[model samples]
Target: MSTTKGHADRDVTEDLLDGVAGWGPVLCHLGIFELVPVTFDLGIPLVARWMNDPAVAAYWDLAGPEIRTTRHIRVQLHGDGRSVPCLGVLNGTPMSYWEIYRADLDQLARYYPALPQDTGIHLLIGAPEDRGRGVGGILLRAVTELVLDKRPACRQVVGEPDVRNASSRRVFRKAGFDFVAEVDLLSKRAALMIRDRLTLYPYEIPRFDGYS
Candidate 1:
C-alpha cells in the first residue's frame, strides 16, 4: 500500500531523501546536533546494544541479538534511497538513532492523507542516562527543524510513537508537534504526530483531554 505514484519511475540514482548525509549539524539548546548517516561497521554494534535495553525493546521489539539489528538496518541501507538511518550525535557523542524517510512514498501513506514530499521520523534515545529527562524533546526539535530546513519541499515532519508510551507522546508535543490521530499499525497502536513548516516557531504546548 505504498503511495509512490510520482515516485514510481524516479531515477534510482536520485536520492529520495535529498542527501541526508549532507544536511550538516544544527545548533540547539542542548548542544550541536548532527545526523550522521549510518554505516554497518559503526552503527550495528551500537544500535544492537540499544535495542537490547529493556525500555527500548518493549516498544521496538528488536531485542535478541546483533544479527537482528544488523538485518533491520541492512534493509534500509540497501533498499531504494527512500529511508536513511542516522546516528544522532550531540556535541561529540552518538546518543540516539533516527530514520528519516519520505512518508508520501512510504507504507505509512496508506494509513493517512499524506502530502507530497512529506517527511517521516523514527527515533530512539540510546542510553538510559539520557532517558526520562528533556533530552528527547530537545533532540526531536533540533532534528525536525533540520529536516524542514534542509528539505524545503517537505512541508511537514511526522512521527508515529506508540500510543501507550505517554512519555514519547509528550516529548513530541514538547517538540512542537501536534497529535494528529490514533492509527492502528501491525505491531502497535500508534499516536500520529505532526510538525508543520508553517508553525515551526513560537512553540505552543498542545493539550490532550485524556490521551494517556
Candidate 2:
C-alpha cells in the first residue's frame, strides 16, 4: 500500500512537471495578453449572470434558488478534494472557468470506460455585452492550452451538455473535443451528451474498488 501510494504521488508530480514544461514557451507569450489561473472568486457574478441566463438555464434544468445558492459555485471550486478553483481571466477580467476533478467512473460506467483521473472544463462567458466578440473563443482556447500544458498525464477531458445547447457544443468542438456518447438523464427521454478527447493515460482505476 505504501509503495503504491508513493508511486502514484511520483507519477502525479511527473505529470505536473511534464505539463508545465511543455507549455513554458506558450506561457511566456500568454503573459503578454495576461491569460492565466483556473480559480476565481471575483468572477462569481460573471459565472452567475451567464449561467442564470434563461436561454442558458433552459438546458441545465436549474432555476430559482437552486441557481441562486452558492453551493454550485462552491462545489465547482472546492469539490473533488481540490483546494483551488480553475478560473480563466481575460484582459485582467474573469471570463471563464474550469475544474480538474477525479470523479467516480462507476456512475459513468454506462457510457465510458473507467478512468483514474477525469478532468473537466465548465466554461462560462459572462458580460453578455462581450458575447460574440471572440472573448469566449479566446478564453476557451487559452484554457485548453493551459490544461494541456498543466496536465501532461491526462489522456482525455470530459464534458457534458444538454442536447439542445448548440452554442456550447460548438465552442467545445472548436476546442478539439470529439463527440463520445449521449447519456440518459433521470427523465429517460431528456439526455445529456458526452464529449471527450483521446489524450491517452498510463494508468486507470479498477471498476470495483469496494469503497463506494
Candidate 3:
C-alpha cells in the first residue's frame, strides 16, 4: 500500500484516498461527523449487521454472513491505496459506514468518463433511526465537502447507487449530485451521480440559528 505523511506526522497509507485518515471530523447540521478508518477487529461485526439489514441488503447485497462482509472489506483494506473503508461517526457514535475511493482507478472508470482525482463514495446509514429522515443527504453533502476540501486534486465526487434504489438516488440528488447517466455494472444497473466542485457552494449545508 502507498503511504503519505499525514496529521501528527503519521505514515498513513492509502494515499490514493489522499490521507483520509487525517481528514478528521467535520461539523455538520446534524452533529460532529468524522470518518474514522476501519479496523477489522473493531469494524466487522457492526458493519456486518448493517449489511444484513433488509433495506441495506436490497442494494448492497452483502446480506448473508459476517464472512461475506469481511471479504468485501478485506479487499479494500489489503489492496493498493485506492480505497479506504471507514466508520461514519456522528456526535461520538458510529452510525454509518462509508468507502471513500478513487473512482478514476476503480473498475468504475471503465463505465464512466473518469477523470483523474475523481473521488467516489459508498455509504450505508447503519441504524434504522438514521434512515429515511434526510440524514443521508446531510452526510452526503458533508462528506463531499470533506473530499473537495481535503483532497485538493479532486474536482468532483461521484457515486453509483443502484438504479432501483430510488431513496438512495433521491438523497444523492438532494445532496447536490447531478444524475449523469445510468450505467450497467456487473451487479446491477446504477445511477451515476456527480457533484462537481465548481458548483457545490450553492447547495452547501446551511447554518442553523444556534449552531456555530
Candidate 4:
C-alpha cells in the first residue's frame, strides 16, 4: 500500500492559516513573494485559470487543450496527503504554481535514493511577463528557503527538471542546487538537482514572527 494516505487536512492548513485576523493578517511571505496553500474554498478556480493559460501550460509542459481542469487539480491535490498545492503571490496577485511534496511518498523516490526528509518541488511561473526576468530564480531560492525552514525534518530539497528545460536547470543551479546527473523518468530525461539543508540555513528552524 501507499505510505501516503487520505486527503489534505483542509481544516488544519486552511483554517489555521488566518482566522479572525482576515486576509491582511494571514498574508505572509519570504521577502516579496507570498506562498499560500491552494485550498478548495479559495484556490480551485484560481489554479484552474492559471493551468489553462496558454503561456503557463506551455512552460509547464501542459500545452494541450483544457487538460488541467478543476477536477484534475482536485484529484492531484489528493495525492497521498504529501502533495501540497500552492500559489506564489506577489503583491496580492498570484504569479506562479508550486507543488510541494514529500519524495518518500512519491513515485519519483524510486528513481533515486530518497530519504524520509527529502522534499520535492514542482514549480512554474504562470505569466509570460514573469518569465525571462529572473523571477524564477529568485522565487525558487525563496521557496527552497521557505520549504527547508517550514518543515524541520526535511534534510534536503530536490527537483527533477526535464533535461530539455535548460531554463529550469539554470534556475535550480542559481538557487544553490547542484546538478546530479540525468535520470530517465516518466519517459523523459530529467536532470536531478538537490540542495542540502546545511547549505542554505545553518539552523534547522529559525524563528519567523510573520512567516515560517
Candidate maximizing TM-score: 3
Ten residues in sequence with the least summed lDDT for candidate 2: 1-10
Write model 1 residue lDDT over 57-107, tens digit each, in one string. Answer: 998999997999888887776677677789999877999999898888877
Q: What TM-score does candidate 3 reach?
A: 0.89
Model 3: residue 45 alpha-carbon error in angstroms? 0.4
Better of 1 and 4 by TM-score: 1
Give candidate 3 regions above 4 Å deviation. 1-12, 202-212
- The true-versus-predicted C-alpha distance at residue 124 of model 3, in Å, is 0.4
Residue-by-residue lDDT tens digits, candidate 4, 80-130: 456666777776688787777676667778877788858888888877677
Candidate 4: list runs displaced more than 4 Å: 1-5, 8-31, 53-55, 59-67, 201-212
Off by over 4 Å in 2: 1-41, 61-67, 76-78, 82-85, 103-106, 186-212
Each candidate: RMSD: 7.8, 10.9, 4.7, 5.2
Q: What Cα-based lDDT does every candidate model obtain?
A: 0.82, 0.46, 0.84, 0.67
lDDT of 1 at 94: 93
Question: Which pairs in model 3 have colliding backbones?
Answer: none
Worst 10 residues of 1 by lDDT: 1-10
lDDT tens readout by residue for model 3, 1-212: 11122342223344567788878787798988889988777788999999999999998889997999898887777666677889999888999999998888777888878889999999999999888999999999899988988888899899999999999999999889999899888788899999999976855443323335
Worst 10 residues of 4 by lDDT: 16-25
Better of 1 and 4 by lDDT: 1
